[model samples]
Target: MRIGFGIDFHQLVEGRDLWIGGVKIPHHKGSLGHSDADVLLHAICDALLGALALGDIGMHFPNTDPAYKGIDSKILLQRTYELIKARNYRVVNVDSSICLEAPKIKKYSDQMRSIIAGILEITGQEVSVKATTTETMGFVGREEGLVAYATVLLEPVKVI
Candidate 1:
């Protein structure tokens, strides 16, 4: 099995919609970026890419491209998975964490897991989503931003 890890961070700002793991959460501040800025999904994408040594999300989905402007991160995740499949690899499982200071996400984690699993065409049990707070410490604790980390295990596709 191949293992890969990734992390992403986004600044919090007013007016943008808060999206994490493809779920839009009610929050006063949202992650700012060229796309929807779903940190969880972005990290997952990077992890999948990294597993294949394909580079990070920015290289595939450059912010400089207008085509990705205001794009939904879920689409990015889908494309990333496609790349793995094309390389004859399949995701074994994925574990991820989200760190933020406000708008507690415990209640929304299940839905996030379900959505992520569906996108990856994997069982919900194969995907894990967790959330935590910074306990009033750094940028996240100050509610200035939110971050996410993801790790994935992949295996070569078995041929019949």
Candidate 2:
């Protein structure tokens, strides 16, 4: 089995929509980025790529590329999974977490799990998502931005 870890952070802005793990959350501020800026999804994509040693998200989807402007993060996630499958590796499970100071996300955690699982073609039970605060420290604690971290376990696909 191969283990990979990834982390991503995005600044919060007033105009953008708050998207995490493919679920849109009602919030006053959203993550800022070249795309839809779903921090959780981005982190997961990075982890998947890392597991296969295929480089990080920025390498595959550069911010300078105009085609990615305002793109939905779910598409990026799908492409990343396709890369993993092409390498003959499949995700066994994934664990991820988000750091944010406001907008308690417990109610939406299950939905996020389902969305992520669907994109990865895995069972919901195989994906885990958690959220926490920074206790009034750093950018997350200050509500200036949010961060996400993901770890994944990958193994060769069984040809049963």
Candidate 3:
């Protein structure tokens, strides 16, 4: 099995929609970026790419490109998974964490897990999504931005 880790951060600003794990949560501030800026999904994409030593998300989908402007992060995740499949590898499991100061996500966790699992074509049990606060400490605690971390395990696809 191959293990890969990834982390992403995005500043929170007014006017943008808050999206995490493909779920749009009600919040006063949203992550700012070229795309929807779903931190969780971005981290997962990086982890999957890292597992295959294929570089990070920016390399594949550059923010400088207008094609990716205001794009949905879920589509990015799907394309990343396709890369994994092309290499004859399959995701074994994925564990991820989201750190933020406001708009508690406990109620949305299950939906997030389900969405991510569906994208990876894995069971919900195989995908873990956790959320936490920094206890009023840093950028996240100050509510300036949110961060997400993801680790993924992959194995070679078995041939019949």
Best by the lDDT measure: 3
- Per-residue accuracy of model 1 over 1-160 as CA lDDT, tens digit each: 8898999999999998999999999999999999999999999999999999999999999999999999999999999999999999999899999999899898999999999999888999999998899899999999999999999999999989
True-structure lDDT of candidate 3: 0.97
Candidate 2 ranges beyond 4 A from true positions: none
Clashing pairs in 2: none
lDDT of 2 by residue, 71-116 (tens): 9999999999999999889899999999999889999999999999
Please report how far candidate 3 places residue 113 from its true position, in Å: 0.5
Worst 10 residues of 2 by lDDT: 84-93
Q: List the residue pairs that clash in candidate 3.
A: none
**Every model's TM-score:** 0.98, 0.98, 0.99
Report the poorest 10 consecutive residues by lDDT, candidate 3: 1-10
In model 3, which regions exceed 4 Å deviation?
none
lDDT of 3 by residue, 1-160 (tens): 8898999999999999999999999999999999999999999999999999999999999999999999999999999999999999999999999999999999999999999999999999999999999999999999999999999999999989
TM-score of 2: 0.98
